[model samples]
Target: MSGSDDQSGLLVLGPLLRYVDETSASVWVETREPATVTVQRGTDSASARTFAVHGHHYALVELDGLQPGTTQAYTVAVDGATVWPEVASPFPAPVIATLERGRPLRLAFGSCRTSVSHDKRGNETHGVDAMRAWALEMAGQVQPADPDDPDLDPSRVPDLVLFLGDQVYADETTDAMRAFIESRRDIDQAPWTELKDYEEYAHLYALAWSDPANRWLLSTVPSAMIFDDHDIRDDWNTSQDWRRKMEATSWWHGRIVAGLASYWVYQHLGNMSPSQRAQDELYAQVLAHEGDDELDFGDLIDAFADRVDQQPQTYRWSYTRDFDTQARLVVVDSRAARQLDPDDRAMLDRDEAAWLDEQLRGDVDHLLVGTSLPFLLARGLHHLEAFSEALAQGAWGDRGARMGEKLRQTVDLEHWGAFQNSFQQLAHQTIDVAAGRRGRAPSTVTFLSGDVHHSYVSEAWPVEPGRHVESTILQAVCSPIRNPLSRNMRFATAVLSYGIAGPVGRLASRSTRVPDPPLDWHYAEGPWFDNNLACLQLDGPSLRMWWVTGEVHDGDHERPRLAKVASYALDADGNPPPREGTVSKLRRRLRPR
Candidate 1:
C-alpha cells in the first residue's frame, strides 16, 4: 500500500520491551507481504504464525510466561526472515529488559527535530539525527562501552523516553518530501499542495520515520510522544485571530484532520497501556474487527479527529505516569486542548485545566511536568507577559489592545504566558504541589520542556510562605535538541529579557493600577543558548540536571563528541552523611506502591 517501491527491510515497531506483570507484549512491523512473527527465549521458541489482519502487514506478538527481574535477549523473524542483528547474529543481541522494580529510573527527553539525510555532511555536523545519536549508542556502534560513558550512544538508553512534542513537522518537510509532493501537485497554488489529506499524511509519517538509524532506536526505546504546533501547522491555536486566519484556508481543514488521525496511529496508539487501549473507543473497534475492512477504521478515525478539533475539551490529551515513589511524570497537550476565546484565551481549556489539577496532586517524592512549552519564560519575556496581560485587560489606559498588538507582533505570543489566566492557574497548581499543600509533598517539581529553540534552566523560589502560586514556584527549562537560535537573537533575548524586564516587571507590579500584583521573578539558572541534548539523573534523593552538546573541537574522531554545556544538581533537601547522604536516605525509605 506504499506510494513508493523502495523495498527496504522490515521495520519492527514497539513498546518493544516490557515492565513487570506485562502478560503480553505486542510488536508492530511493516512488510512487503503477510508474514509470520516469532519470539524466542534462550533455545525455546514460540510458534511462528502469520498475522491474519491485513496484508498491509502488522503483528502483535503476545509474549507470555516470561520471568520478571531478568533480561531476555530476543529477535524478530518476518516470513521466517530474521530482521534484527542479522544472525549468524548471536552478536550479543538486544534484550527484552525486565523491570528492576526499585532501581533508579532514567528518562531522556527533548524535542523539535527535522528528518534530513544523514550522509557525511549532515551526520558529522548536526550529530546524526538526535534519535540516531541515541540508537547508535544503543547498538554499541559508537564509543565508551559502559552506561556511564558520556557519549551519544543509544546504548545509554534510559528506562523510558518522554518525547515532549513536535515529533513530526507537517509545515516543514525535507527535500525528498517536498520533491514527492511536487511530483503530484502544484505547490505554488492556494492549498499549496502540502499535506492535504489522509493519503498525504500517511506518506509523511513514513518519510518521518524511515531513517534506518533513528527507526532502530525507536524500535527498542519505550517512547511517549505529544504533538506541538509543527505536527499540524505553525503557531497552531496561538489565538482566535491566528486560528480564524488558518481555518479560512482550504488546505488547513484536511491538514488538521489528517495530522491528528496519523498522530493517533503512528504515535499515540503505542503510548497507551493495554488497559488504556481497551478503553479507547476507536482502538477497541479496530481490535474487534478481523479483516482488511477499510470501512472498519478509516471512518471512525476521521470522525474522532474532527471531534477532537471541534470540541477541544471532549477528549483529554494529558497523561500521568508514576515511577514507584521516585517520581511522577505528567505530560500535557498544550495545543489541541486550548481555551481560545478572544477576551479570555488560555493554553488549556477548563476540562484540560481540571485534568491537570488532578494529575498535579503530589504524593510522590519528586514530580515532573512535561509541557512542549516552558511554564516559566525568560525574565524579559516574563515581563512581556505581565505587560500584555495588563494592556489586554485595559489596565494601560485606552490603548491596551494596541499595546498588546505591538508586543504580539514581535514577541512570541504562543507560549503559556500568552494565556495569562491559564498560566496563572498552572502556576498556582505547581506551587501548591511544591509548598506541600497537597498531601505528600515532592522534594522538587521540575517542568521538562523544549520549543523556544535554546536550552536553559531557571528556578522560582517562594516569595510568600504557604502560597502555592508564583509567590514560591521554581522553573527549569531546556530546548531544541538540534535547532539552535541565531547568535544575534540569543544575545538580544538575553539582554532585553533579563536586564530590562527584570526591573520593569517588578516596578510595574507596584503601580497600584494592577489588580493581581506581578510576580518577583529573576534568571536563576540559564538562558544557555545551544542546540543540545539534555539528561536528568535522579539517583536516590539527589537529582542532577544538565545539558550536553556535540562540539567538533579538532577531534581525530569523525563522529561528533558530547561536551557538558551546563550541569547542576538539586541535593539541598537535607540528605546527610557526606557524599553518600542522598543515596543513604533514599535506600532507607521504602517507596509506596
Candidate 2:
C-alpha cells in the first residue's frame, strides 16, 4: 500500500516512531515485500526503499527539518498506497512529537517483558501487563479512577519510553514462539524451543511488538532499547567460564550471530539519531544500495555479528544524548562490551569505560545512566557478588576458583558488584560528578536500570563522611513490565540480599582483597515484586518518580486498569524524605507477595 490507495498487502510489522529530537524523527517498519516506504508527517515527508534482511523487507525512514515542539500525526505508505492507521484503528492516531527546547523531560522506563497471551489465565499466571494497562489508560479505555486518587498530572504525557532490556526472551519462549520453532525445525535438537537464526528472531520480534495495545504505544511514543541477558539467553556473557561453556556448545555460533544480527536490525538500528546512524557502515550500505530487486543484508549482518562477537572493540553499542541542558542520558551496553579475561575482569572494557567516563560529567539538571543491570544493588548482594568474583578469580587456588565459578553462575552474581574494577571506576566517577568535579553538579545523578524483576529506589551518599556531595546519587530500578519473579525467588532475594550486609561485607573483605563500596544507601521506597512500569519527570531542580502496575478490576481481565504502586520525589536539595531506614526493615514490612 502506497500513500493514497488501499494499504493491505504492503506492511507487515510497524511504523514505529523512534529516536526523536527537537526537529527530527525516524520511523521504522517491516514490509511484506520490497517497496519504497514513505512517512508523511504533516507537511514534511521522507521515504526510503525497503532493504531486505534475510527474506524480510524493512526500512528506516528519517523525517527531518521539521519545526521544534510540534506534534504531527503521521501515516505510512508503501509503493504509493496508504497502509497505516488500518482504516479504522481503535487506538489514537500515531504522531511524531518533537521535543520542545527548555522543556521538562518526562520519560517512562522499565525492562524485561515477556510476550504471552494477555487473557485471564495469562493475567493470573504472569500478573497483568503494565505497559498494556498504561496504553489502555492513555487511550481512555479503562474504567474511572478513584476520585480521591485521580491520575497524577493528568495532562502530562511522557516524551520518551526507554526499555532497559529483554524486550524479548529468546531463552524463555512462549507457547506461540515454540509452536513457530517446532514448525521450522525438530523440537528435540540442541537449542530446541530457543531462537536459533534471523528468521526465528524476526518472528520473536513480531510477536513481542504486535500486541495492539503495545503496538499503538510504540507507534506514538519514541523508544530506545538495550538488550539484557534474556534477550539472547539467561546469564549471557556472565563470565569467562560461562563464555567457555557456551562457546563449546554445538549451536553457540548460530545462536550468537542471530541474536546480535537480529538485535541490530530490530532494536539497535532505531536507537541512534539520524546523524549517528549515517556513520554506521551497515546502515550506509543499505542507504547506498540501488535496485528494483531486494537487497539482502543477510551476509553483511551475519559477518558483522560474528566479527563483532570476536572483537567487541570493533563496534560500540553504548550511546549518550543530552536534552538541551535539562538532562543527559547515557544508555550503556553492559552485556556485549565486557572485559571477561580473568586477571583483567571488568564489566566495561577499557574503551567502553573511557566512553562512560566522558559521559558521566555534570552541568545538566539531571544525569541519567541507563544500564540493564542495576549498578547499586542491595548492600548484602553487592558484598556477596564482589566476594564471589574474588573467589572465582582464584583468591585461594585453582580448585577454589572452580567451585566459586559454579557458585557464581548458580546465583547469577554477575552485576556491577561482581566486576569490582569497573564498579569502582563508575562509583568514583559518579562520586566526582556529585562532588562537582566534572562541572556544576546536576540535581541528581541517577542510575536507571532493570533486570532484577522488582521495582525499588535507593538513595546513596559518599561513604567518606566528610565528603561535600551536593547532588543526589540514586539507583532507580523498575523491572519486568510483564514477568514477575517466582515466590521462591522473592524469598531468596529478600533474605539473602536485604539483611546481614554487615557480616557479608566483613566476610568478603576477610576472604580476599575486596575494596569497600564507594557509597552506602538504603531503599527509599520498595522492592515490590509487581509487574510494573515506572515514570520519571524532571521539574526544575526536583526529580519525581512513580511506579504503576496493571490492576485486574472486578474480573475485568481484558481491561485491567493502571494502578500506582509507589511514588517518591527528590526535593530541590536532592534528598528524599526518610522512607525506609534499613534494607532489613524493607524486607520485614514490605515483604514481596
Candidate 3:
C-alpha cells in the first residue's frame, strides 16, 4: 500500500472514475484484449463486457447501490483479476465518492493541455503541468474525503474535475504523436501531422492519459469533459468561409468523422447518469445485447458520428445536472452545435440555444454555466470581436468585409462576442436569472469557461437595470493547465485585451449594426498567463474560487510543487467580491488617504 511498481501491459489505460451520484459511480477502462471489466469494493462488485471500436476494446462499469456521503477504496479487474493498484503502488488507493443530498460541492476545472515530456526541457518549453502537480499533492493525502459529509475534513482533491476543452490536441500533435501518426500513414499526405482516424486517436489518448501521475489523479477524481476547436481543428466552424476552406481539403471528411466518433467513445459516454445513458439509443443498443460474443461498435459508432456531424439536430451534446438544491451545472456544447451560415451565424444552433435557455434558469444556491469558450472575454477583446463580426457581415463594404473575414480567421477572433445575437440572448437571460424573472435568484450566477490560453476574472453588471439583481453575475476563466501562450503574445494580450483596446474596439463596432451589450464588465482579478488549474467551491449560500499553478522547486521539475496564485469569494447581495483584498488596501496604499 506504500509502494508503486511502474506496471506495464496489464491493461491499455484507465480505471478512470467518470460519474458519481448519491448511490452509484461509473468506471471506464480500455482493455488489452476482449474481456469482462469489473469494479469491486470489498465484496460488492459490478462488471461489464468489452465493446470493440476499430480493434480497441473498452468498457464502462457502473457500480451502484452505494451509500450516500461515503468514500470507499475501489479496485479494477480484468476477468476478475485486479489490474489496478498493481500489487505494489506508491499512490494511495482510489475511491468511489458519492454525494450526499444538500451537501456542498467542490470542483476543479481548466482547459488546453498539450501532451509533452515532463522533464527539464519540456518544463522549460511548456511550463510545469498543473494537473500533474495536483496529482502529486493528492497522492500524499492519507484518505479521500466523503465530499458532502459536513463532519469530514476537506480533501485537497475535488469531487469532480470539469475539463473544459482541448483535452488532446489533434491539430497540434506532439512529436511522439507525430511519430505515431507516421507509423500509421504517409507523412507527406494531407492532415500530415494531424490525426486522421480513430486508430490514431486511440494512440493519442493513450499518450495523453498513460502518465502515471495524471492517470492516477484521473482514476481517483471523477471528470466531465467537453471539446474545443483544437480537439478537431483550429478555428473549427469559425465562419462560413472557414468551413468552406476546411471542406475543400481532401482529408477533412475522414478527420471530422473520426474526431466526433472517437470523442463519443473516449469522452462523452461516461458524462451521463444511469437514467440518461439508458435513454441514449446507442448505449441502449450496446447494453441490450446479451449474446455470448462481445459487441463490436466499430462501424456503428462511425456511422453515428457521421450522422451527428451532418445533422446536429439528431442528438444533443449539451447536458445538465443538479446538486440537490445547492448548484446546477449546465455544460454546453460550444464546438459541435454551431450555425455557421452567414445570414444566421450563431455560436450555438437554434435547438442548442433553446436547450441552453431552459437550463439557464435560477433556483439553486449557485448556478454554474460551463461553456468551453469564455462567454465574457476582456471588454476590449469582446468589442473587437463584435466589430469584426459586423464587418465580415458587410457592415462596412465588400472590401472591408473581405478584410474582416481574413482578420477573423487570422487572429482567432471568434467567441461569444463575435456572435452578438447569441451573446445578447444569454446576457439578457443571465440578467433575468439574477433578477428572479425566470426562477428564484441564486446567490451567484457564474460562467465557468476556458479557451484562451490566459486566465482572468471579470465582474459584470446589467446596464440600466430597472430592478435589483439578487445574484452576483461573474465570469471566471482558468485556461491552459499545461500549454501557455508565448511571452510576446502575453504582452499583446495585456495591451490589446486589457487597457487601450476597449475604447478603440467600442468605437470600431459603433460603425456597424451590432447592438450594445446589455451587461458590461471589467476585470476583477487577472489576465495572468500562468499554466494553472482553478477550483470553485459552493459553501452553503456563498461561493469561493482559487487558482493554483505548478512551480518547480529545488530544480525538481518532475515533482513540482503546487502554489496558490489567487482567491476570491462571492457575497449574498451580488457585490463584486472585494477585489481579492478589497479596494480599501489599494486605496490606502495608492491614494494616500
> What's each prediction's TM-score?
0.84, 0.97, 0.94
Residue 475, candidate 1: how far off, in angstroms?
Answer: 3.1
Q: List runs of model 3 lying over 4 Å from the truth.
A: 1-8, 141-154, 572-575, 580-593
Please provide, for model 3 over 333-449, each residue's C-alpha lDDT reduced to its tens digit, 9 standing for 90 to 100.
987899988899898999999899889888788899999899999878899899999999999899999989999999999999999889999999999999998889988889999
lDDT of 1 at 14: 33
lDDT (Cα) of model 2: 0.87
Candidate 1 overall lDDT versus native? 0.62
| Candidate 1 residue-wise lDDT, 1-593, digit = tens | 12222324654343143222223344445444555566665653553333322123444454556565566666766555566544353224656554455676677788887666656665444443445554554565554223464533444557676777777778877677788788888889755645677766666767666655556555555567788888898778866656787889877878888888777776776666667766888767756755543232556677889999999877766777777788888889999998778676678887888888888877776788899988877755655666665565566666866666556645655687667777777766776776677757776678888877666666665546545531123455656665555556666655655555666864663352433423445554566665556777666556766666544434423344444555656664613222222223221211210
Best candidate (score: lDDT) = 2
lDDT of 3: 0.84
Task: Name model 1 segments beyond 4 Å from true.
Answer: 1-26, 32-66, 85-92, 123-128, 144-156, 291-296, 389-410, 465-474, 505-524, 553-558, 572-593
Which is the winner by TM-score between candidate 2 and candidate 3? 2
The candidate with the higher TM-score, 1 or 2, is 2
